[model samples]
Target chain A: MAAAAAERERVPFTFSAAGLDHPHIHSMVQGLLDAGAQLMHIYDENPDQANALRAKFQTGQVVQELSAILHSEVDLVATSIVPSKRGALGVQVLEHDKHFLSAKAPFTTMAQLHAAEDAVRRSGKKWAVFYSERLAVEAALLADGIVQEGLIGELFQLTGSGPHRLQAETRPAWFFDPGKNGGILCDIGSHQIEQLLHYARCKDAKVLHSKVANYAHPQYGDWQDFGDATLVTDTGVSQYFRVDWFTPEGLRVWGDGRTVLHGTNGFVELRKYTDVARSAVGDHLYVVTDEEEIYFPAKGKVGIPYFRQLIDDCVLGTETAMSQEHTFRAAALAIQAQEQAISLTKAGERR
Target chain B: MAAAAAERERVPFTFSAAGLDHPHIHSMVQGLLDAGAQLMHIYDENPDQANALRAKFQTGQVVQELSAILHSEVDLVATSIVPSKRGALGVQVLEHDKHFLSAKAPFTTMAQLHAAEDAVRRSGKKWAVFYSERLAVEAALLADGIVQEGLIGELFQLTGSGPHRLQAETRPAWFFDPGKNGGILCDIGSHQIEQLLHYARCKDAKVLHSKVANYAHPQYGDWQDFGDATLVTDTGVSQYFRVDWFTPEGLRVWGDGRTVLHGTNGFVELRKYTDVARSAVGDHLYVVTDEEEIYFPAKGKVGIPYFRQLIDDCVLGTETAMSQEHTFRAAALAIQAQEQAISLTKAGERR
Candidate 1:
């Protein structure tokens, strides 16, 4: 009883879940709950989704409206609403004196991005994003630690291949709408950009080139099935990433996402989702340095520490989870890439 | 004895080695020899190089001058001369009524490319290039067959990562001169473009964006150690490739070259040189199709039929090895990328 009281006294962190539009919300809330944060409330316009969240957590008082979550005594509000609404909701959460945790791509438009920035600056509250590809995946976390330790020397290049299956029939109408889901580069490609930024240890980078194409998905109406971008940092490190909705049905996983990091001394490759024919296992990391070649299977052992760090950041007014600037910069870069992306579908006509 | 004579009569291909500059000439010559082509003569400005070629082959006669081979009865002249001079050499060989096989980047400048094209048109002689990365690598050959068989469906994208060790101390002085070496993209990047074009079944591709950086190699005097480019084909199949001279000394091979081909029904990845930590063995191919996932270790199994095909093409006026148009297009695309490459080293100054 004394220990329980001391635990609550030592770290008083409470958060609520709102806008359960994406399945990612489950993992996001579960991470915080696992970190011992109290779930204060749950809200979604869809009663089924709200009920689902309540049943999963078996906690959180169900709320009827978004205003209720905003008005609640929660320290933070986590949301995975329609991507275009995420930035606005973040602004509202901050205006109510609560920190915000958002699913990426956090903002579908530049105006929303700016508004969120203004709200955070004016309210002095955290605005964090869940870039689960890097933060939640154990192999990525392990690679980050290895890179930080200089095991592979000065990192200079990163190449990411993010391929996701397009379960078009199961998706909501807004998922196919570019304004709501953001472009492919802004949506799935954000995960790549964020991971590259964190791994390269850069404050900012220039988007040298970007392109998007509908390819075989003209039926989806303005939906891009393929996108790629190249970016370079002031320190001269470079990144190239490609995201597409063509993951074959034979793969055991939804995608076989992979990344290769080039360093001065050696290189590292992360088979994030699956190692293809070698094994059905994901989180396979291959590290090659001057002294040795190492293979690390990062499953079950390396825990996701981002959630705990984020909770502490909210409670203690810190930036350990991720710097507010880094989060904002990643979001902005994705938006810029989307805004400036050339259309490959018009290549023949342009020529 | 009759079978041996019949085999000799069946192939009846004669070739000579000239302009022994880069060591790629060794393999270029060996592939032909393995394909039962006769090495008639060898010539180089440097007598020591000519002697080295003669010693390696233990066959070709060491000619005193280029004219000896150019004016001789040799059917084809294979050369890995200085990059800038290759086009002129090809023109001369073609004008002399002999088929010309030059090591890639084939030509350094647009003027040279134009001159070579004119020569080929006038002389009606073949001007082939040895893109050994795709031609000689067994795994690549296997993947080509797989794609040709429609196992991967309609290929739409290719990504290549080519990293090479500089070994500056051992390199000739011409290598550090951008003008002489044809820059990074026109040189090593040609291999990537060639492979991508071959895999994607693209005859021509526009260089969407390209950049080169000296990064860590300014001491080498205008030597670009890194280059990357994005290209899109007329059919909308896209390609992105990066070539660098930063292969760490730790790697067992010269570089860890990899290529990934994304198709409608599946994807194929070629670990050409080494599979990093997993194995020192090269030619590891991973195939993920709609029906099954397969792995192919192609060492000593898949024979390189390119040299034999080239010999047949020369003898019978067939385009079996690689079409004349495809060869020229790959070379032209690489030169175009090099010609338009942006310098990333000056990015900070520009900003």
Candidate 2:
């Protein structure tokens, strides 16, 4: 126990955060801490947010300016800013020769993605996205294992549906704006895009048809309640995914986050959130292969392996974690789809 | 009952079938028979198919030629032919001054839709599509009642998902051909289009974006295993829908068909075919409204009123079942989308 405590105190890499807007910063911090990262400093434009986080974590010093962390000895910056601002913050972090860990959908537009890409290329620093849908979900990890083991055969397609509850009144005002949220495809759809690239093992894909609509939320006309796109990867894997804000109150969770992967021989479905009305717990994976129709409640079976691997990559200068190109392309496809999507009103008018 | 049977034998309007290939003809026949229409004759290119139906129903006589039905004294001809041929046959039936009841996706192409429209203009015969999704699903009817009663308030969107088991072995060769099957959007997506027009109460709508992909079966190269589209009705009601042939073997029904209608006040989800893993019985309607959040099993409550209304219109020159233009436009949009949809392969390659 004394040796473990001594090792913890002798941790090599120190991490801090620049942007503290999204709630994901909590999960980001927890994952980093779990991966042996020592929090040193935290900074946000809003002092209250930084101070509250600082008090809760009871470690990181709250800094008044962003540059304080830049000048500090922090080895990495884990941040979750507004979608529109995440890219620039990432560039700043990487330019300081520090690794950058971003919340999913790090950028609202392709231009921002390109800028981040350039910064990462120039700085040779680790840049990773916390795509929680895949990275956090144990079912997804188990499913990925099954696919990698050739249990389901060659993968052909992935269909992802993220139906989220709209607690409209509780959200920040900027959440209702397309420019701020990056539309549905770039926001929630980013998770699906990353999942496709990872599970399908494809380098790039093209958006075939993409669309966004404000069905019931005409009050927030510029906001999209629903968005969908069809994509075909460079290797010929087809994908169709939808992200929507139409989850009913009966659902146990914030969303019925699910993904269905079709293979040449069989398929797997990851009920990442609530398993319908059947169970209170989530991570129910249904695997249908010729040999078996297995229902797995895969709790405790899978850990957040990405975080540990990412930490190793940041320290060792390895590409064992997710590649920067793959990350950038995934975000690029989502942002491109969001920018290219045609907007439609509930009454069938194209705006 | 005997008196009712005798009255049905002497019904004023006589109905025959021109395309007797699809299994839906049984439902069409049963619905029409229930509506006091006299079944007289049936015709198909394949005599065995026509004879099989003639023997099973033991009501309609087997006609050797299509022209016999066209030239006969039948007041209506119900048909479900190869999608590519459906429109021309409807045109032929309408030109002979007979009301036509078509299977969903009455036309495979915009040109075919236009031709049928012209024929209707010339002959003034009722042209109908059997969009059984809304017409046959009792839950949809119950939800429609709630909608018509203003329980859900101002309408905003309708999203539908129809996932059918491939049953690839039992399907005909033509079913694998895009040219014959009319692609996914024109085929299964027709039902969604019809439902959108009905629930949103919009006579016209535009297909903003449409997509189709062959994800699993590369053997059926041209066939689309999945299709989706975004649409907006003229009244500002937006729609996003998907149709896929990826229902796993675990599903009880051929499809876990469902529809959700979002309004200003609330939303209703109609589990049209089955309640999936939750329940065995179909037509499970869930309504989330201001007054109550309730689940209603409308299995026996909502009978096939469309057939009865259709019969009334056929003889009485009424438009109660569904408007001719509304039916045409729905099919037209589906066909238009099918034509306009870009194709992609399983490897994410745009073809």
The top-ranked prediction according to lDDT is: 1
Local lDDT at B140 for model 2: 85
lDDT of 1 by residue, A89-149 (tens): 8888999999999998999888998898899889999999999999999999889888889
Score candidate 2 by lDDT: 0.81
Positional deviation of residue B163's Cα in model 2 after best superposition, in angstroms: 3.4
How large is the C-alpha RMSD of every model relative to the true structure?
2.8, 4.1
- For B1-351, candidate 2 gives per-residue lDDT tens digits of 344345446765689977865788889998988777889998888988898888888888888888888888888999888878888988888888899998877777788888988999999999898998888888888888888987777677777778787888889988887787788999999999988999888898988777777766767877888788878788767777878887666555677677878765666778787664456688887776655566778899858789878877776677888998889888988888888886665433345
B1-351: candidate 1 lDDT, tens digit per residue:
344346558766788888988999999999889888899999999999999989988998999989998888888999999999899999999999999999998999989989988998999899999998898899998888888998888787899999998888889988888899999999999998888778777677899999987766656756787889999987788899999987877787888999998987889999999987778889999999888888889999978788878877777677989988899889999999998998877422222
lDDT of 2 by residue, A1-351 (tens): 344335445776689977888888999898888877889998998898898888878888888888998877788999988889888988988899899999988899778888887998899987889989888989998999899988776787787878787988778877887788888899999999999899988899988778777766768867888788878788877677878887765555677677878765567878898765466588988776645466788878877787777777777676666887888889999988888887665433344
Which prediction has the highest TM-score against the true structure? Answer: 1
Please tell me how candidate 2 rates in CAPRI terms: acceptable
TM-score of each: 0.96, 0.87
Consecutive 10-residue window with the lowest summed lDDT within model 1 chain A: A1-10
Each model's C-alpha lDDT? Answer: 0.87, 0.81
